[model samples]
Target: MWEALVQPFAEFGFMRRALLGCIAISVGATPVGVFLLLRRMSLTGDAMAHAILPGAAVGYLVAGLSLGAMTIGGLLAGIAVALLSGFVTRVTALREDASLAAFYLISLALGVLIVSTRGSNVDLMHVLFGTVLALNNSALILLCSIASITLLALALLFRPLVLECADPQFLRAVSRLSAVTHFTFLALVVLNLVGGFHALGTLMVVGIMIVPAAAARFWAISIGGLILAAVTIAVAASVCGLLVSYHFGLPSGPAIILAAGLAYGLSLTFGPTGSFAARVHPYRHADA
Candidate 1:
């Protein structure tokens, strides 16, 4: 059993690289996801994912498939959209969510238009779906670097972030770091999404971020518990997804997301925290 599970990664360099890339992404993306879920900005993560597309597409237009070009393009586009949406929310009557929705829609359309017009169908597929099995050393380094940065940023932002999520008004009243914390968090979201796009593509990378965090909610109530559970779920899903992709000749990105979806399904049904089984058989309490 161990050999069956370990053989592909041991035998194939591509499989090993893919495994490492996915693990890095899982570690970096899951914590951001937990906070996004806590702040009820799950869909915001999705929006930011799509918002990076045009910049990546433009990068492809300018430099073919160069990793550095696409990474820079996607990062710029994502940060621009995030900052723009926040600015609109502050200056205008529109809410942040609504402003974000507007910008992301425009960004998605523009990106698709650019790719479809300037690139071939094959290029479109590569941009939209990613090629996980073909990761080079540079891509691996980028993923690892992003993961490291994310961990450090989260560590620094932990207390402010928790306060921001738990009591926004109180946090604002107590500290001027509220806005700084929010935008910094958004920048991290952009950074991780850009990194994830190299492996999972824009459409599916958000799945790695959001789904595991959502599933962890079924098992953990505290912020720390949720982060730990989400990371565990994400890493396990990455491993299973890679093995299934290797054995079944399936696309790696979708396989990973689907594996995460399965975890979510099980967590929903069987987890001890507000799951269906838990609801059906409530724990009895006695008066003291």
Candidate 2:
């Protein structure tokens, strides 16, 4: 059993690369996800993930499997969507969510059309679902670099970001940094998503970012603890999903996401924060 468990990573370089990429993504992206959750912008994050597709599709059409091309395309697309959504929200009466939903849907349809016009369904699958186990050295380097940059940026912006999340109006009232903070956070999200798309694709990258963060919320009370819990959950899920994919020939991206979903489910029921059991049996815990 131990041999069966250990042999895959020990024998296959691709599996090792996949593991490292996913772990790097988790470490870098999950904290941003926690902030998204706190800001109640989970849906916005999902929308931005889809918005990345059209740009990536265009990149693929032009450069044909070039990571740099695809990464730049995704970043541009995601930023455009984010900026457009903010603009719409400011200019019109529609809320940010509605604006994002409309734009992202259009983005997704455009991506599909572009991909269909230029590529096969297999190529489309690759763009949407990614090829984690096939990460090259360059991809690994990109993931690790994004992780380092994200952690550093988060560390620098922690206070302002926390204030922005907790009370945006007050943050704005106190300083001009609010808008800068917001945009920087969005850029970080785009960077992480672009990095993630290399491993998990446009569709599934959001899951890697959001699911672990959601699961961790039920287990952590302080902001520091929350970030730690989210990262831990994400990394653990990545390992488990990789193992499942190796052993059973499942899709690595969705397998990793499913592992995170399972953790979310378990946390919802049993975690320390506001879990089902705690809610249902408050008196029992109080006595204990």
Count of residue pairs whose backbone atoms collide, per candidate:
0, 0
Question: For residues 1-288, could you state the per-residue lDDT of candidate 1 as single tens digits?
Answer: 888799999999999999999999999999999999999999999999999999999999999999999999999999999999989999999999999999999999999999999999988888888888989999999999999999999999999999999999999999999999999999999999999998998998999999999999999999999999999999999999999998898999999999999999999999888889878866722221
Looking at model 2, residue 225 earns an lDDT score of: 92
- Error at 271, model 1, angstroms: 0.4
Predictions: Cα RMSD each: 1.8, 1.1
Compute each candidate's TM-score over C-alphas: 0.97, 0.97
Cα displacement (angstroms), candidate 1, residue 142, comes to: 0.3
1-288, model 2: which lDDT tens digit per residue? Answer: 887778998999999999999999999999999999999999878899999999999999999988998999999999999999999999999998899899999999999899999999988998999999999999999999999999999999999999999988999999999999999999999999999998999889999999999999899999999999999999999999999998899999999999999999999999977999778886775676
lDDT of all the models against the reference? Answer: 0.94, 0.93
lDDT of 2 at 68: 93
Kindly report which residue pairs in candidate 1 clash with one another: none
Q: Identify the runs in model 2 with alpha carbons over 4 angstroms from their true place.
A: 283-288
Candidate 1, after superposition: displacement of residue 38 in Å?
0.4
